[model samples]
Target: MRVLYTSIFYLLLPFILLRLLWRSIAAPAYAKRWAERFGFFSALTTHKKVVWLHTVSVGEFLAALPLIRRLQADESVQLVITTTTPTGSERVRATLGDSVVHVYAPYDLPDALARFFKRVKPSLYLVMETELWPNTLAACAKRNIPAVLVNGRLSEKSARGYTRFGALTKPMLQHLSCAAIQNSVDAARFVALGLSGDKVIVTGNIKFDLSLSDDLRAQAATLKSQLSNDGKHLVLIAASTHQGEDEIILDAFAQVRASSFAWARGAVLVLVPRHPERFERVGQLCASRGYSVVRRSEHSWNGASDILLCNTMGELMLMFGASDIAFVGGSLVPNGGHNFIEPAAWGLPLISGEHLFNFAEVARLLTDAGALIKVNSAQTLAEAFVRLLENDSLRVEVGNAALRVALENRGALDKTLLVIADYLRKS
Candidate 1:
């Protein structure tokens, strides 16, 4: 079954590169680093224990930052961080800045994995989230490397997909030394999909362990002052908006402005699309709806535009800090929701659509705390915004509750570090 899977992957290689070429038309960064993907990067010369950490994209990289920082304190281990996306690569560079070995992850083909293992020579692999590959895990097991799946989450949809390929899935999971899952429900789902029950433990979500710096707080304060126009305008930021969700958000914002309240009349809408390729399209979408727009790239923000389009990266938390209310996107569509943890950390009242299987545990916590509101349509979204906007006291109450939930959920990072300590020593 594994051989068949590898053969199928080999046959699909050209189509994969073709799709990569197509995506590069929008995001040029995707075009570079082809050699690294083929496991052709220069070999690392390190006497220290090599620990490879894999984070597929920006979200996972950001979520794993605190853990990465903690691991860095161990001088005995040489960290080689791998990110599948260019944005994640850029983030690793921008934030870490030569502190670790950053590289593009190798393709999951057997030959590529073999070449990668020969070059990188990792003794322990910390695979973040759902980046399990049969070839990669097999190579790790063959090399006697302890591969630990950190901050693991197995959604029901993904579990079903894995179950369909149980022949390959069970062996791949059996290779893992351990999996520190987010919640018991997700842990049970992983066990059901053939991960050994004893090897999986519920350490809670590490995303709850977000570290908000004083510098970030200061930046948020300055942004809030600049965006609120000296406390006159009600600032509402819709963060991480997906392709389909933007239209609903724009229509909902229009409806929100229709309210008789003075704050609603002068409310400012900040649109931050999920992907950089869609930044121009989102700005254009706002203008097509007759809303004046200002891109963050323009660097001329005077609070005049109806929609403040965040065309920049790595400033999402700052955006959340500057906002009075936050409506997290991705849930509005079928794409399982994004990280609503940042907004909740910033103590901003949260709103999202119904789909939240990816973040079911975090969603439950915030919803129970009265910090999150789930809206199904534009009308309901607008009503949610109005309800929060009209009652200042209610907003403060919910925002405080959100912050409390964030604070209460701390220590996952510590538990995860403990879980992986034995694995790291296996080197």
Candidate 2:
């Protein structure tokens, strides 16, 4: 079955490459790292004991940062991190530095996977979130490398697809030695899919451990001061926003601007599109809405624009610190939402759509603690924004609650490190 899957993948390789070429026209990183599909082969020759960690994109990379750091600090292991997206690669490079090897994961074709396995020769493989590739898992199993899924989550939406192909999905999941899931719900779902209940442990969401270093916080503060001149009444930042969400946020921003609230009178909106390819589109979207916009990539903000489009990578957390409130994107449009914990870690009051199945546990915790507001539509989002902005006392109350929740969830990294260390020792 794996061989047949690999053959099918190879047969479609040319078209895949062509599509990637088309995407690279807008996102140059795609073209720039075209050969990175075979990166594992090249990396394997240098390190004696390689531990491979796969993260799909920026969010997963951020969630795995502390674990990556811990792995690098271990003298017995050499960490090799793989990410599927350019943003994820950029984040790993920025955060992990020279301590770990960074590469793009190969396609799951047998030849590619075999070459990758032969080169990297990983003793252990750690996959972040729910990125399960049958061929990749099979390759690791064949090599006798213990593969584990860390920070695993199984949503109802994803479970449906898995159940649709239960035969294939069950065996693929069972290949993992263990799955350190994000919550009890995820654990239950994984167990239902034929994984041993004993092999699935609820570790909470690792994203709750996200925090900016003092230097990063200081830099963001400086940038905020430069942009606002310390004069803006409040700043509402919408980070990692998707397509429809951006329009909704813009409408909400306009409403807030027209509102009677005191803080709304001088409030600024910072819009950051989720993908780099859409940065210009987002900037244009803001401009078409008749707002003076400043692009962070091109200009040092001077606080004059109605909105600041943060068209840069690896700075969302810093941006979170500079803002008074945040609306996490990918939620309103049912993309399952991005990490809300980034803002919460900074004690910034947050707003998000009702659909946060991706980080359901974290969302529930924030809602329970009165740390976040859940809005289902544009009007409610505007109301939440205005209410938080106008009432400084309420903002501070929610902010404190958010900070408390973030602090309370800090030990996942430590616990994960213990598990990884044990694995290394046995290996």
Candidate 3:
């Protein structure tokens, strides 16, 4: 089955390259990293054995940052991070600077994996979330490199899909030195999929351990003061919005403004589209809605724009800090929403759509505590916004609930680090 899988992947190589070229039309960074994808890059410092940590994109990259910092502190290891998206690559560069090496994760073909392992020669491999590439794991196993899946999660839907290919997936799971999963449910799923029970442990979600730095809070404070003139206006941020969610958010914001809600007066809406490629489209969308808009990258808000388009990257947490009310996107559409951990940590009143499989447990924790409400449509979202804005008691109640949940759910980082320490000790 693994052989067949590799053969099929080889057959799809052309289509994959074509898809890269297609995406490059919007994000040119995709075009420039062709060599890296094929596992062609200059060698890193060969003096120290590299500890390679792979994160798929921005969310995974952010979730891994705390762990990466922890790993970097160990001067015995040379830390290198790999990301699949340009945005993640950019974030790694901006956040870590030259402290760690950043590179594009190679395509998971055998030859690519071989070349990558030969060049990078990682002593230990850690993959954030549930990115299980058979070729990559096989290569790691072949090299006798310790490979652990850190902060791992497996939703039921994903589990079912993986089970369909148990022959291929089981060996990959067995190849993993450890699976430091987020919850017992994920641990059970991994074990059921052929990972030994001893190999899989519930270490909880590392995202819960996310902390807002004083510097970030200060930046948010300054931006909030500048934008709202020190609480003169309410700030509504629809963050990580998808293609369809922006239209709904704009409609809902318009409805809120037209409604009799007193807080709607001079309210500013910030639309932060999830992908950088859609930044221009979102900016145009807001403008087309008759919103006077200012891009965050331009850094010149006239204090008059109805909508502040956050075109900048690596500033979502800061923007969330400034929000009076936050609507996390991806849920509004079928895409299983982005992480709501930041908003909860910031103690903001949160609203999301009904679809939250990606963050099912986190959403449940917030919803059960009255910190988050799920809206089904634009009208409902508008109503939720107006009600939350008008009722300070309700907003405070929900926001406080969110903060309590965030505060209570921390310590995952320590537990996760313990798992890594065990792996290192055994290896």
Candidate 4:
């Protein structure tokens, strides 16, 4: 099965490159780093122990930011980081510039993996979440490098997909030195998928262990003031929205603003699309709906703009902190949802759609704690917004719940660091 899979992958390589080229029409960065994907970057020559950490994209990098910083404090290892997407690479460059040796991750082909291993020659590899690749794992095993899966999660939908290719998936998982899973359910899923019980430990989610500086909070306040044009404008942020979700969110925004309540009438909706490629389309979509849109990159958001289109990178945290209500997107249209941890950490009341399978446990915790509100349609979403807007105390109650839940889950970062330290010591 492994050989067959490799052969099939080799056969599909051209089509994959072609697809990247096609996608580059909208996201040009995809076309820029072809050599890096083939593992042709300059080799590291550091005498210190080298550790490589891979994050697929921005969300994972943001989630692992605290952990990455923690590792940086220990100068014994030369930290090398790789991101699969250009946006992710951009984030790594912008946030922790020169702190780690950043590069694009090599493709899953054996040749690319061999080149990557030869260049970096890392002692330990930490891959975030579900970024498991068969060839990558096989290379790590062959090299005797400890590859740990940090903040691991396995949804049932993903489990079924893995079950389909059990032969390939099983050995791929077994190659891991250990998996620091997010929850017991995910840990159980790893065991079912062929990871040894002792090799899988539930370390919770490091996202909950985020560190927000006082400066960031002040920046958030300043942004809120600017968006409101120094007036009293109720801000409702629809964050990380997907393709099919923006329309529904706009409809909800319209409904919310049309309500008889004066607060609703003066509300400003901050729309942030999930991907950079969709930013222009989303802005046009808002304009088509007769809403006055403000692009963050073009100009500052003011009182005249009905929707603040957040097209900038690395500012979602500020947006979350600036808003009174948050609608975490991707859940509305079966995209399995993005992380709601950021907004929750800000003590903001969150609303999401029914499709939260990817974050099932986290959603359940927030919902059970009376922090998260679930909605299925534009009408329900509007009602959720109106309910909180009309009752300030209700918003406060939910927000407090979210903050408490986030604080209660804070030790995950420490646990995750301990696990990494243990593995690094062994290797």
- Who is ahead in lDDT, 2 or 3? 3
lDDT of 4 by residue, 1-427 (tens): 7789999999999999999999999999999979999999999999878989999999999998999888999889889999999899999999999979999999898999999999999999999999999989999999999989999999999999999999999999989999999999989988998999999889899899997899999999988888766758789999999999999999998998899998888899989999999999999999999999989888766677899899999999999988999999999989899888899999999999999999999999999999999999999999999999989899999999999999898888899899899878877
- For model 1, the superposed segments whose C-alpha errors exceed 4 Å read none
Winner by lDDT between candidate 3 and candidate 1: 1
Order the candidates by lDDT, highest first — what do you get? 4, 1, 3, 2
Clashes of each: 0, 1, 0, 0
User: Taking the tens digit of each residue's C-alpha lDDT, what string does model 1 give over 257-349?
Assistant: 889998887899989999999999988899999998988888677867788899998989889988999999899998889998899898899
Candidate 4: regions farther than 4 A off: 229-231
| lDDT at position 284, candidate 2 | 90
Q: Cα miss at 376, model 3 (Å)? A: 0.8
**Model 2 C-alpha lDDT per residue in residues 1-427, reported as the tens digit of each score:** 5556667778998999999889889988888766779644454555457899999999888888878766767787888889998888888888768778888899987777777777678899999989999988988888788888998998988898889878778888878988888888888988898888878777777777766788988887886776566855688899888888888999889889999877887798888899999999988988998999888887766656788899889878878888889899999998898888889888899899987988788888999999989998889999999999888899999999999999998777777766777788888
Report RMSD for candidate 1.
Answer: 0.9
lDDT against the true structure, per candidate, is 0.92, 0.84, 0.89, 0.92
For each candidate, what TM-score against the reference? 0.98, 0.95, 0.98, 0.98
Q: Candidate 2 — worst ten consecutive residues by lDDT sum?
A: 39-48
How large is the C-alpha RMSD of every model relative to the true structure? Answer: 0.9, 1.8, 1.1, 1.0
- Ten contiguous residues with the weakest lDDT in model 3: 418-427
